[model samples]
Target: MSEAESELVQSITTPLRLEYQYTAGVASTRFLRGMADGKILGQRCPQCEKVYVPPRGSCARCGVATDLEVQVPGTGTITTFCVVRIPSDSLDIDPPFVAAHILLDGADIPFFALIQECHFDEVRMGMRVEAVWVDAEDLGPTFESIRYFRPIDEPDAPFESYKEHL
Candidate 1:
């Protein structure tokens, strides 16, 4: 077919919609339950004695199933972050927010949390922050149970102290 003829042909179009049901595994269930209860949970690596937030289920490093549950505190240090200047309506939260990895207290590994209630420019690495939980009505067994993290009154962690975590 000539290029003009091919271009004149109507393009085949079909609307596609896909839905999925995600079943949280044992480790995730336990962690999400903790979030529902307004608590942060971590799994300890039996082999390495390292605590991982959200319960690694198995130690990624030592290749052993995690041992016990450790209660992580809401307050954490911002290990790293990215400031999104672009705006998108599909985002759960508004744009101009910082998406950060937080090193929660008592947990060796960090977890992702949105930084709200503060200016994007004010967010910094090693900044101390705390979780802001959703209301009781919206509470559930998911990360959404906690709204986001906000800056706390504590001083930023020293580079020397959190360098290893980075």
Candidate 2:
């Protein structure tokens, strides 16, 4: 094979190595408890009336301490997505998956998650999606508490549905 072809093959076949560790805080404990019950929790900003999922202890937008704990709807719309042709060592999923930015209903910002049980090409912006909760017994104080999101059978959401979320 030519040098260019050989380089391309090597690049495609080589796996990238990544390593990292995360330590949770006290606020995270409560968030995990909510997830164990199949609830999506968020911290609400009293000043701006915005709710953040995967709840942060403070409001970054308003730079204020937000203490109100609210339950956000699991149903949401896909704001954006990319097909994951490459896999990462930290990921628990298979390759060629779809990663998406979803704006849960009643949330102020979009959060990242995986989309599965559907075709990659078929996943699109503004598509309605719902949380696929993990098995109750398997729930934890981490993102793993909730499984991936799946495309809902509902009709395609209109452009106005998730445009601002982008």
Candidate 3:
């Protein structure tokens, strides 16, 4: 085929789909209970005053066992983001989405999630975002319980807001 035709064909074709699955021990029943209640729960690292979402049973940084359960706020600032032009098998969202690292208010570390309800170009690295909660009836013991992050109406925060988390 001509070079132009080959390029056109490649662009038009979709990639193959691959599938896999694995079985592991069930996650903690307590963690699931937290998500169902519209709460972002984390395990605390007293040594560093750091909180971990998907609450860890132990602190990876300080190498100390953690048992405290902390509730992280839903509001956060975008530390960084990438305009996703390509869809991946693991992601449920459509293409041209924004994947961002959000530093939850009062949390030491940032959590990765999608930024929706705004144009990709309008999303900035330090934009303010708030969690759009899933329907109360739809709440579950999973991250999906919180649907996605949406732009906040508040004034843009200074770079200092989430700079260190990055």
Clashes of 2: 0
- Which of the numbered candidates is closest to the native, going by highest TM-score? 1
User: All models: lDDT?
Assistant: 0.88, 0.84, 0.81
Measured on C-alpha atoms, candidate 2 has an lDDT of: 0.84
Q: With candidate 3 superimposed using the best TM-score fit, by how many Å does residue 145's alpha carbon deviate from the native?
A: 0.8
Tens-digit lDDT track for model 3 on 115-136?
9999998999778899998899
TM-score of each: 0.86, 0.81, 0.78
Model 1 regions more than 4 Å off:
1-18
Question: For candidate 1, lDDT tens digit of each residue in 1-166?
Answer: 9888777656778989899998888898999988888888899998888898888599999999996888978998999999987888788666778999999878888878899888999999999999999998788898989888999999899877667787
**Candidate 3 positional error at 13, Å:** 16
Candidates, ranked, TM-score: 1, 2, 3
Write one digit per residue (lDDT tens) for candidate 2, span 40-159: 888888898788887778888789887889898889999999999987888877888999999998987898999988989899988899989878788766777768999888887787
lDDT, candidate 1, at 54: 86
Please give the lDDT score at residue 26 for candidate 3.
28
